[model samples]
Target: MDGRKSLGNHFEGVAARYLTSRGIRILERNVYNRGGEIDLIGQENDTLVFFEVRYRGEGSLATPAESVTFPKQRRLLKAASYYLHRHGLWNCNSRIDVVAISPGTVKKYRVQWIKNAIQAGF
Candidate 1:
């Protein structure tokens, strides 16, 4: 794979491990459809979470979370809708989340988990 794609996968794996440690069970990863792509899909309690994992390496100007802009949010929502329909999970409780990762001074990476970071209907 390309360098960028490989890096993304590696970071997604990191994010998955971090979430798993906190009790979330991963259902899918790298879900792609006509709508767009979802980095991770996991179950937290009774909620089905669609995670958008963003990573900003060292010396980046924008934070990882800040990179998920309005357009990105719309694409993520569309992809999530497609995922639900494909899995016949219309009745399932779901939300879009963001896992932002950036280089850290003390730690190897700083991970931020933002629940319901992107909402539907817009």
Candidate 2:
């Protein structure tokens, strides 16, 4: 795969592991829908989560978390809506999350989880 995709996959893995470690059950990855795609879907505290996984390679310009823009949020919201409708989960409490992964030093990686990073309007 290309570098971007590869990096994203790495972040997804990291995000998944982190979420799992935090007692969140991941339900889906790269969920595609009419609006756009939600990187991850999970359940935490009886709430449905739509996640966006972002990663920045070393020596890059922008911070990993800075990549999620307004347009991206719109797409994510659309995707989340489609997922909820398709799954018949309209009533499920949901929110968007962002998991940012940055290249770490030789010993470890840095992962940041931003919960309720965006909202979906009905």
Alpha-carbon lDDT, every model: 0.93, 0.85
Model 1 residue 6 lDDT? 100
Report the number of the highest-TM-score candidate: 1
Best lDDT among the predictions, by candidate number: 1
Instruction: Assess the local accuracy of residue 2 in candidate 2 as a C-alpha lDDT between 0 and 100.
Output: 100
Q: TM per model?
A: 0.96, 0.89
| Runs off by more than 4 Å, candidate 2 | 1-3, 105-107
Backbone clash numbers for all candidates listed: 0, 0
Residue pairs clashing, model 2: none
